[model samples]
Target chain A: MLKESLSSFLRGCRTWRLWTLLGWLDIQQRYARSSLGPFWITLSMGVMVGAMGLVYGTLFGQDMKSYLPLIGSGFVLWALISGILNESCFAFINNANFIRQSDVSLWVYIFQVLWRQMIILAHNVVVIVVLRIVFNVKGYDHLLLFIPGLLVLLLNLTWMSYMAAIWSARYRDVPQLIASCLQILFYITPLMWWPHMLKKHQWIITINPFSSLVDLVRAPVLGAYRSQLAGVLPLFLL
Target chain B: MAEAGDGAIQVQCLKDINLSLDKGDRLGLVGENGAGKSTLLRVMAGIYRPQEGCVKREGKTVPLLDISLCLDDNATGRQNIRLRGLFLGLSSEQISAHEQEIISFSELGDHIDMPVRTYSTGMRMRLAFSISMAVEAEILLLDEVLAVGDSAFQAKATARLREISDRAGIVVMALHSSPAIMKFCNKVAWLQDGAVRMLGECHEVIRAYDQFMHSKEKTDA
Candidate 1:
């Protein structure tokens, strides 16, 4: 059974063309009949970052020039990670019909969710770029680090999705449970606040896995690698 | 094959089953509702796994258990055909090769450009049947899909099935109509409560089955 399942998982990965097409279909069907379609997410993300940057920078007494870009990259990457993890829970359950009738692998559905989330992440990239330019965010030439960071984050999320898919298949309430946990994780993570602000409570940032994951992506984009050691160390260990 | 629920309660949909077939063999499955006929076909097609036993099958098997195998109603009929063909292990080139054939066979000219959800049930069935028939498989497992379509289309589908079975390596079908059994199958397996009660030549087993059903109905009356 172990060998069989492993081969099936591998086979699912091999059918990239199939899952890629299905992923596109998923988005097309989701926003069917809508004028804006999936671009709505990109537009909304842009508006959200703009509004949050102006208000939060003033409340925290920080200059919008640097603070806006930080929050923008953090939130955009956070949305991608959380979206992949949350959607993974329903990956297998949603494909019950295809699973019961066809010989398609279970991993195909998980990959579909991953692929769809990646598309959304691609759209969210525009927000990050616009904020970087608008705020004149300057950093070291470690921009290449962003590629590896994003790839590692994606790798971790892929396995996490598979784990969630397995556990959620057995427990019907797992998806809801995951959603609530992510809700709490979102608040605790440093998406909205700077980690330096919590100097004494720095353990909150170190102990939380989401903090590490967010830093892996955000530190590269923002070029704050020295302070992101707490995030990078754990990811390297993983 | 057993679908386990909660705790120790396991509903064994099929058990103590053993059967084999060779090239050009057509086996008809007859059973009442929930007697595991469809389950058996799925087991044969490798869609379901049996806990106690294993099924060893050679060659590709096309299972027509559901006509809308994975049809996206949100997608146009042409897209649906392409998607369904991909799921069936066809390459883009192969699907493109058969695209014209399937479209013409379904007789959905301009309608093929429309989403499948816009098509009527019969139209969807036609699209599914056309796409399914276009694929070439050594083994075919069908579950009462012939009961689809209007009388005319049904006749046409039956003839197509006959032609495919002649060239296919093996054909296993779960059906309710005894006449369909007599006409299409060479062997019959009668299932009762998840186990095979009788298996033999189509005529002999079907005759015994008819007699049993007749007497049982009279008694119930």
Candidate 2:
């Protein structure tokens, strides 16, 4: 296990270059002949977040400014985590040629998919920044706490990337299952709705490991929430 | 490299293993259906890495197994060449300097600018053979690249191979034309049942193989 993990970590680091290339290649292949390209992702997020923020705010009786940033921040970070896990499963599947023929490191495939997610997340980051600026949301002034939290999130995603890729490599049905799970997680998590509103049933949200991750980013920035028990389960699970 | 594996390559449709490229020599391989030519060539390439023993390469080696396999279809041939070249043990700087020469040699035209997925099989072979030819490794492992394309293209490739040989590089290839093999290869090794049955001068071994096959044909008749 140690040897495998060591090799995996090394290969994982080495694959960063290959990951960038493949992510770029995938994006190019997908958007070829299109002008809007990545901006399409931007446009879709804008529309979805705009519509979601408007509907959920009025329905939940929350302030629009406070609610939009919460939803936007929650969705953005959750998507980053879920996106890495969701996409990591298909990394090796799509590159069957390289897996069978090319003898390069296998971990490179996982890195490529995760890197691609990071790219899309990067494009969506504009939404977060825009939400912060437009809604007058205050970000954490404590860079120390923020940095470590982001590090934990990044490290956790890396683990998920490995697990997801290996699972998919073994079973072809995994990627689809993961996609559905992400959809369910989005609904179950307090992403569109505020966690505090579910005070009686808050255990469901608190038990969620992602809620910890979500609060790590969402609470500090929104200043309305602090992770009391949301992160404990996942921190221990990890 | 990891210790070799015990797995054996099972033969299915191969005709028979029977051929050789002599010691310290450049050889052109030629044979027909069930001739076991390419399979035998792969065994010789040391790709399978038999669990028992090893295929020795006294010097650097390069195997042009399949031109399409030679490059990642997703990457530019130029970029693919760099990684492929390094895998073949060419330093990055050396690969960089030789990039223009290899692209020019393949005569792939402007298509080299695009991903190899855009390339036809013949074009892939041309690029592969050209790059391997340029690197001129000590031992060249080939798999029937000569007949990969148009006749004119074949002539250009053959001439290029000839030029490669002139530099004292050793070539081991599989082809379907005995005449082609006889024209270029100095020696031959006839393989049967995954073992070398005969190894000597090309014309002599091929002649013996022909006569033996002919007598068997007559007996069957």
Candidate 3:
């Protein structure tokens, strides 16, 4: 099972070039008739963050620069997680033709969705970058670590996408259940909050599969990492 | 009882499961809706492995399961023909040489540059059928997918299919319209309730299927 999943994901990643182009094809197809085109995602993200960040920044008594990265990082990571989970659940079902007919590898469709999300997230990052500059936010030197982290997250997400698509295709209920779990995890996750402030129950943040993921990547990017941040390995971070 | 629940399709939905076709024969499958007719063709095409018995194919099996499996809706018709042809099992060079023939055959005109989504369903089928012909594979399987074309276009499409079968491919078309079947297929297999009720001359199987239905009605009454 592991070998199959691994092979499927590797095939998926290798097809990244074609699928990424296909993902762009879909984006054009989706947004072509509309007036706004592809900015709908980033536009909506901007509106939501501006409102929430203003209200929450005051509530938390934080500056926009400091707070915006918190929101920016959270949103980027959430988009990655949410996009993968949302699309993978229906991957096989949606590509029934490719599943039943295409001679090419079935894993190509998984990469198709993952690349689609990465593209959309790349668009949304423009919003985040704009917010950071607009708010005078400073970039973390360790932000360079995000390149590796993004690489790792994508590698893992490819595996998850394959396993999820195949699993959901068979079990029937796994897709719906996974969708709800993702929604709940978004709220439970500190998307807009500081990880350190949850000192009383930081374990909740630390134990999350995405927690290590977000901490290792996002904190460093937002320049929020303390000297002790490097010591924050998987288990002991909380 | 050819039961296959775990993704292993063992039962060939073909009933009667017996037929003999001379070389260069065109046969249609005609029946009412929900008939096991398409399943029969799929079984023949190796898309659905039969559960109960076995199927023998002297040549390769290819089915028009979907158009986009070969052509993405957003791609140009020119590219789609090559893509779809390659998908149907042609090598890239083979696809390259045949691309022009399929494109011109589609009669898509200047619209060939447009994405396939802009084309009507009939036009899409035209493009799909033309590409399938280019592959030069034996044993063609289609399922009422031809009705999408205009009547004149249908005649040309039928002629292309007929010519291909005459040269090589063994044709098995699952259709509901008896007239269309008669126009194309010299042999027909009648299927109902996942069993082959008759497999013989097109008219004979049609007659048998009709009689069976009439008897069923009398019994129900």
lDDT of 3 by residue, A23-64 (tens): 666677788778888889889888888888889889988877
Report the C-alpha lDDT of model 3 over B34-130, residue by residue, as the tens digit: 6677666666666565666787888755677554535688777876775565445566678778878887888888888899889888888888888
Candidates' RMSD to native: 2.3, 5.9, 5.5
lDDT of 1 by residue, A14-131 (tens): 8888899889899888888899999998999989988988898899998888888888898898889889989999888888767777887878888899899889998999998887
* TM (chain A), candidate 1: 0.92
Model 2 misplaced stretches (Cα beyond 4 Å): A8-12, A143-148, A201-203, A217-238, B1-63, B70-96, B114-118, B131-140, B151-221
Instruction: Give the CA lDDT, 0 to 100, for residue B171 in model 2.
Output: 78
- A58-141 in candidate 2: lDDT tens per residue? 888989978898888777787788878887887777776455333456677777777777788888878978988898876456
For residues B83-166, write the lDDT of model 2, one tens digit per residue.
Answer: 567545566678889999998888877888788888888888888777776676666777776677788877777676666566
Q: What is the TM-score of chain B alone in each candidate?
A: 0.91, 0.76, 0.82
* TM-score (chain A only) of candidate 2: 0.89
Q: Report backbone clashes per prediction.
A: 0, 13, 14
Q: After superposition, how far is residue A173 of candidate 1 from its true place, in Å?
A: 1.3
- Evaluated at residue B221, the lDDT of candidate 2 is 100
lDDT of each: 0.85, 0.70, 0.73
What does the lDDT read for residue A210 in candidate 3? 70
Model 2 earns a TM-score of: 0.74
Worst 10 residues of 3 chain B by lDDT: B7-16
Write the number of the candidate with greater TM-score, choosing between 1 and 3.
1
